[model samples]
Target: MHLKLLYCTVLSLIYGLALGSPAISDSSALADLLESSDKFNDHSVVQAFVEELKAISHSSRNISKCDQCVARLAVGKSLALLRPDLVPPVFTQWCTETQYMSNSTCLSTFSRNTVKSSYTGTNFADMLTLMDPFGYDGQLYCCYKESACSKPKTPDVSLSHKWPAKQTKHKVAPVPSANDTFNVLHLSDFHIELDYTIGAEANCSASMCCTPHSKNTFANLTSHSHKDWNSYYDSHYEGNSLVKGSLIDVFKNDSIWSPATTFGHYECDAPEILINSSLDSIANFSSTNNIDFEFAIFTGDAVDHDELSLTSYEVTVNSEEAVFRDIKNKLGDVPVYSVLGNHDTFPYGELGQENHGFSNYFAWNAELMADLWEDYGWLGSDESQYARKHYTGFSVETSMGLKVISLNSNVWYKKNHYAYWNASQPDTFGQLDFLIDELVESESKDQRVWIIAHIPFSADALPLPAKLFAEVIERFSPYTIANIFFGHTHLDQFEILYSGPGGDAKTIENVVASSWISQAVTPWVENNPSWRYYSVDKKTFSIMNAYNYYTKLNETFTNNGSAPVWEFEYSSREGYNVTWPESAPLNATYWHKVASMVNESVEYNQVYENYAKRFSPYVPDCASTDDCALDYCYLTSFTVDQYDSCVENVKNNK
Candidate 1:
């Protein structure tokens, strides 16, 4: 009896399936209603068919054709409800299919409707109909439309059917040799001022005012009073003064005025011009030497502290932009990178309050930000907002094998007014993490990386733990980073050497460029205002320090009217294919060469000559002269006269 009941249920489900029309009142009578409704081709029959299908779908869970019947009925009912104007040809066929008494006839009518409706130019619809028989399958439909159903045409004989399979061999281009040298004109501590007049007012100190030796020198001295004293002193008096005199009186001495005065001021906008001229010289030199630069990286203190106001920030940005624009114009399309210095942030005002207006200036300038982003893709939009004054981890692929990572060290230090000292900040920790991650990833890729930052990891900046620097080097040892470049300490010549945690100590050479704005007035008599140029050899993956390669000041304005000169000095590696000398301690010998070169250059020659005459009268006439015979005689007579005069003066005084 159970088997008989099961068979009856199956028969009832199959026979009870309704046609395309409105739902019936009783599901058990749906099949009968559909059959009866097919006799009429009027709107009422279509509605009745839809109703019968709906009733079967709702009541008969076991009905196999319930969904199909409902869909067909819904379409028929929709057609019946449509206005005459809205009725399409497909709707007419749907009505006929629902009204027909024969099931096979109704199915044939539906197929005909589909064929007539499938009006695509390509045979895609027909192919889809052959492949899917149900509804559209996305992948099959796409294949049919895009590829399978297209009419066959004569294929190109040269084009292979297994195009990707027949791999076209690509030649691996040669990695740039480390020995392939390029000249990098390294400049730092520019302290460029905008609105020099404003500085002239602020810095102009009546009690501090002293007599300037020359008109130009006096003007610069006066400008110093209005400008930030520290910047003025550092650039002009402290850095550039060649004469051995009191720091206060250095400005008063007319004889020292020529080289002692900082020529780049905001009032006349001389800094922009000087920067441009230096760049021009660098480009010309590079062109002559057949050297191509990887990039030009400015090592912080790019701008002078003019004021902390919004207007001052705007002026500073404009001045900085002008300098960059000139550099870009001269250098063509070479990549240029910059790191923040203490002054780049803001001037410390009365109390501990820092005027944060400069940070906003950096944020709004799209060109400045874009330049940094293009070099270092790691700068996210979010980070750009909070610490706009600092930028870290700018990575660029200079060649197939060479990568550069530029970091901003300013974020690692504390800004106390115009003074910057190494102080730990949360941002510094974040930066360290980011740097480590980048180095590890670069090592994994087996690419050569170079790290560039403004401040060196030296003990003088003691608040910055040395252990951190050591960890950084240790983490990236596997990557075979070529070299790191930095600038900040205004050492005429100094080097900070380091040893990685495990490996032999690598002498990461630090180049301290002489201030372009002003040479320190004390110590060295020679006015050596210069910058370092580096040459990278792509083939060897080595960097050569080409120091003092560009003229900072015009010949006519500096020394005794001689053309501005560059000092070139280099140190050969102790052994080939090694990053550093095995046994040699990281020493200042390399930096000494740079300083010596600047001292020997034409710019320093005049200052040296003047110094020798004033301090060492006994020194022979070593000055370049036409007649060698006359030069020696002049030196001997001058020496003899000085000795006799000294002895007689001593006797008379006694």
Candidate 2:
């Protein structure tokens, strides 16, 4: 019995060895074939055999048909993996049983009708889920109901080329019949400094002016000048340097510094060199063009700091005198009138007292047509104490019928002292009283009034003052204030505010002049640093103008020469026309051409929204204002995609 059992065990062992060795050897061969087939045609029958063998090798117990089935499965997987581009479409057409499988069995399960369905209707989403594990590009194939696939329709991507038509008929107001013609040069924010300082020399060419030196040179010169001047005059004479070293130092040594002597302190002093260059340029332009200006108006910021302190007042007055002298020398007898800026008031000092010493300085510097108490009694019994002796008005005849009303906005700084002092003053209510008085007077005489001030009556970016100013203008509607000219925000924009007796208030046109000191370190300079030139008709009191300004430093220097200058042509008519405020018609064609030219050349970004909100009603008429406000509002409400679309539209239109 033992011998027989031994014989059976030996036979069983031999049988197992023979079978197991072959299976193991086959599995090895299958792995090698599958890996090798990955590089060749995956549709090979041999590749399928290899994959099936791999599956069978891993089974716990061998079945008679396991090897065959494994080989077939491997072949299918190899074909699917290597020829996905071909296999995907075929599988989608034929597969049905296990929707996720790409094998022939699954393919055979689908009905021919189902396989012939449109690609869009095919279970592409499910196929993607199954293929994701294998990292397939699911977009490789799409099934269609027809035997042949059709091309997808192409999308239209061309931009619309039609130009926009003018939305409303913009009627040019009538030209008032006037007899006298006056030539006026409108300038503002003359922050003049003596000698080229505060990057002034940098603005000039080395061949024409001084070479660009290190900041240390500026520092050394400033220190030497301060010590030298202090010893010679008063220690306060430290402000005598033509170019101050650093702003921090200047602020620290404020007492010893004045606006005139210190160069690097503020933007005001830049006008010294700028004005000289500008005057030279203007002279050339005037000679070339044969235009003579009658008078010049400096809107404001005549000095950097308005203070009751003696040194501050002295520096400011001296600076103004120097500017006036320069103007007189350059233009030859053109009287220059200046209105005070917010900075022209005592710095955080007394608001009402006329004898605040700062007021006296202004009075002393002004030509003084009449005493404030004697001429204007609007200030009440304490007029002498609080009224600005320098706050005066004069009428200039642009031609026969056109007149300009230049008023001081600083007067209202008393009630809203915070606006001017805190740098947050809205341009409105502060000057309503003065504006009303001027409007009434101009309307009564039937004179076209060109209201001039330092700060704009309305700015889309800075709207508090604009809204306030708009309300005042609305109160005197249909009176036809020819135009309101201002210069505070530095950028050039036009807003037209037209309010008829019974119609909706229309703030359609408000024109802002650019600053002269274009490249100063100050925020205004960094943003808007161009100047504006105006051309007015003497006979009709009609004004047509353009801003030929740019921000290219080299270009500005090249055109301006060693010193840059600006020029304008002026003429006047014989009589004054007070009855027709809107009568003075502007040249719409010319205006549009100039506007188009400017818009094409310059790029303006939105910087003020909350300010614009104050004057929302008047914004629609303003291209920049409305667009900027809309951009801000859209960004707040929509997704980035929607916001981008709105922005693109504005840019294309502009």
Q: List, in order, the clash count of every candidate structure.
A: 52, 66
State the lDDT at 463 in candidate 1. 27
Ten-residue region with minimum lDDT total, candidate 2: 229-238
lDDT tens digits, residue span 104-155, model 2: 3243222111111222211222222223211111111110111122212212
What is the C-alpha local distance difference test score of each model?
0.37, 0.35
Q: Compute each candidate's TM-score over C-alphas.
A: 0.44, 0.43
Q: Best candidate, lDDT-wise?
A: 1
Q: How well is each residue in 519-606 modelled by candidate 1, as lDDT tens digits?
A: 1111111233345555555453444433443233323232332223443422223211224443322223343343343234543333
- Per-model root-mean-square deviation over C-alphas: 31.3, 29.1
Positional deviation of residue 474's Cα in model 2 after best superposition, in angstroms: 3.3
